[model samples]
Target: MRVWISGGGGFVGSNIVRAAVDGGHDVLTTAHTFVPPPDAAYAVSKVDMTNGADVRASIDSFDPDLVVHCAIMNDWDRMYADRQASWNAYVNATRHTAQAAIEGVDASYVLVSTDWVFDGTQGGADELTPPNPINLYGTLKLASEMVALEAGGAVARVSGVNGQHLARPSTPRAQDRGFGYFVASIVDSLSANEPFTVWEADDINMVATPSLALECGEIMLAIGEKHGTGVFHCCGADAVTRRDLAELTCDVFDLDADLLDFGPPDPASMLAAPVPYDTSLTTPRTDRILGRTATPVRTLIERFREQYAAQVGEPS
Candidate 1:
């Protein structure tokens, strides 16, 4: 398969790039400002997705059989702070990708979205649940989903992507962070005997980057093969609190879980917009479509340990 991923320099996209190349697919990926270290396996384009012409030209040049639109300004504060930029990147850029895919012969477009699309009023939302976004980020992503679906593309809603980005720098940069950073940061803090804190009140469904990337790759491949498209819930099998996840990480890494401090989430104080408390997604229908079950959260965290070890060159 010839695959193209926007924002491949970022965490989730980097994982997708790694999975695609490891699976023996020809891949082309893009970055806006922070270019990822070179990989012989795939080509990287310096495409700013917020620009329509740039998006179209890049996709046209790649001419991929599968296009995964992963580009977005995901920082909640930034999205709320600069709503226009976020809209351009998340909504306009998505429109460009979907337009390119719709025009490109035999190409399938997949828009990577978030569980934030739902307001989290009810736990365990499924693919059939209506999106009730609460913040700017969620609103834009939901709009992107509509654009993609309207253009006859696929939407894969994911949550809390955590794992190592293989193509990133060995010495971590500020932007080289993901949900996996939570585990990595805690490990580092524990190593230095520094204090660490985990949220006590919130719950989220966290998907390991490797598994999410693989599932997304498979979904894109299936869409290309069958020329089909729709929304799919791709997330971990279970929901866990920050405290539980932190404890599990400490246990997996042989750190002192007793040193961890618990704190309640105050979205109003910490975020520029309202955030979901429990955006757990259930993927039974998606599993049925893909003919596979999601990896358990504990198992995925262990896999994260392996990737984290590789990133830091430490024993797992």
Candidate 2:
């Protein structure tokens, strides 16, 4: 199958590009600013997703059998700092991409969404649960979801995705830029003998089902291959809190747990957006559809450790 992926230079999209090439599919990908290293297995192009004409032209030129829209403005700090840019990246980009996919080529479309679409009053939300986003990021993501679905496309809602930086692997600490960068940041701090703090929402810690970017990418490909529609929960099976995730990272990387400190969530921190306290998701429908269970947290962390070690030229 000929597959085209948006945001190919991003954490999750880069993994999807590798997975598509590994799966023997003809792949075309787009990046806005950060151009990925050239690879013989697939093609990469610079396309402004927020521009309708650019998006349409790229899709029409590729004429892909499937188009997976993974581009999103998910930086919590940036979302609050500039709402208009976030809207353009999320809502506008999604609208243009979905239109190009459906109207230009009639290609099967799968949108990469997030579990933040749900309110934190409850966790383990399934596909049937109605979304009630609490922050601007989630609201915009929900809007993007609606756009894709209204255009007769599928939505793959993933959570806490992390992996090695495929686009700029040579850059020092490049893994600290995208979703799930906290894990790498923690490792970096502890390795440097510096103290690290994990924040909590009052007495309760924020929880999420973290998944590896590569695994999420494979699941997305499965959705596109099956021509899936509606929502699919593509996340880790284990719902862990912020502290638990930190402890797990320390364990996997054999770092010092004594350096870890606890604190309340601070708005002055890089995470300025109002995050849901517990946005963990369950993947029963995704499991049934893909014929596989979501990965466990420890297992995912172990894989991340290996990838990080390889990126840093350390023994895993």
Candidate 3:
């Protein structure tokens, strides 16, 4: 089967490419400008996701049996400060992907969503849980989920994504930081002997790259081949608090506990009320239907350490 994946250069997209190829599927992927593996099985193309013409042309040209909408304007912290750009990236990109898929050979679309879509209020949320996104980024993702679902696509309301992040650094600007740029920040803080803190009380879900992509790849193939589409989740069984995650990492690396910090989440940070104190997903339906489950947080973090050790050329 021919599969078209947007955001092919991203952590999730690249891993999906490998999974799809391993599954004997001909995969075609795209990057923002030029960001893909040098010798990737999937033919990589640069796409302006916000531009409908470009997105449409790419989909039409690929003529895929399935479409994976993994690319979105996900500027994590910046979205809270600048929502207009977020709208263009998330909402506009969704519009383009939907319109393009509608014109395809009845492509099965799978959109990647986030746990942030929930207003951090619900506990043990199910697939039917209506999204109460707290931030503009999550709000747009919810909107995009509706867009993809309306196009008769399956929406994967994913949780936190974690893995060794890789990208060709722009230039010889500064020292080479570690993988998982976000986690790297923590490592850097530890190296500087500075304090790094996170909300201790908030629950968070984390998924590794290979695990998340493998689940998505399998689901896309099944949905496309079987003509089954709906909402599914990609998250681990055991969820960890933000504070616990930092502490776990510190323990794994045998770093100083003083280098990490934790506290209650700022209630005012999100727009949704009754914030989902435990945004964990009961993925029984997902596991039963898809025959897949995401990796545990420990394994996910372990992989990161392996990759980190490799890049640093030293043992963790």
Candidate 4:
């Protein structure tokens, strides 16, 4: 199967590209600003999702069997301030891509979504979880999902996505980037003999990149191939708190857990939307369809250590 991905050079899309390529499928990836991943046997093109004409042109030219749309502008900080970033990143871009898919592209589409749509009232939620977004980021993403549904697109709503790529020095991540990066920060702080703080109040059922891609690829391929699989949830092994997550990484990387500061999440420092206290998703329908549970957090963190350590030239 031939696949095309937006945000192909990013954290998740790159993993999807690698997995697809390794599985003996043809892939075409695109990046808006970042230099596209080095030209591999599979093609990586430059695409600007902000421009509908360009997105349409790229889809028409690729003519892929599957297209995974992962280009989201998730500036969560600006979401509640009436900022247009989310609208531009999700709403407009998705509507444009939906038109391209239904009228121009030949591939089946997968729209990656988020767990934030639930407003943190429930845990172990599934695709049937009613969406009541408390912030613009989730709200716009929900709009984007609705837009893509016009084309019968497959939806993969994700919560936390961890694991980092080889540090190109170009891809700088922040503490709030994802849980894995936060773990990385804790490691770095310890390495530097500095102190770091962590929130101890939530549980996570997050999906890392490759596992997410596989489940997404499987379901969307089914959807695109006329198998009639509708919406699905792509989640991880089990839920863990930030405190436990920190301790796990520390033990794995052999860092001093003593330097860590665990406390309740500082409300004032938190983002506008309430983070899910228990953000766990159960996708039995997804599992029945895909035939497997997504990867466990323990194994994922070990892989992260290996990958990140290698990037830092440390013997793993």
Q: Which candidate number would show the highest TM-score if scored against the true structure?
A: 2
Structure candidate 2, residue pairs in collision:
none
Tens-digit lDDT track for model 3 on 8-123? 66766655665688889988887886556576567876788888888988899888888888886645566767777778788778778776876555677788776767766665
**Per-residue alpha-carbon lDDT of model 2 for 162-222, expressed as tens digits?**
7776766653442221236668778878888988877765423277788888888889899
User: What lDDT tens digits, residue by residue, belong to model 4 across residues 39-140?
Assistant: 466787778887898888888888877777888774566655556766777888887666676667656777777776766666667777777775576678
Residue 312 in candidate 3 has what lDDT? 56
- For candidate 1, the TM-score is 0.87
Q: How many clashes show up per model?
A: 0, 0, 5, 0
TM-score against truth, every candidate: 0.87, 0.90, 0.76, 0.83
lDDT against true structure, model 4: 0.65
Runs in model 2 lying further than 4 Å from the true structure: 74-85, 170-179, 203-205, 265-267, 270-273
TM-score of 4: 0.83
What is residue 145's positional error in candidate 3, in angstroms?
Answer: 0.9
Cα lDDT tens digits for candidate 1, 201-304: 44422222223444455555555555558888766787765666678878888888877887754344355356666677788777777776877877876776
**Which candidate should be chosen as best, given lDDT against the real structure?**
2
Q: What are the Cα lDDT values of the candidates?
A: 0.72, 0.81, 0.64, 0.65
Candidate 3: the clashing residue pairs are 120-275, 120-276, 121-275, 121-276, 122-276
Q: List the residue pairs that clash in candidate 1.
A: none
Return model 2's CA RMSD, one decimal: 2.8
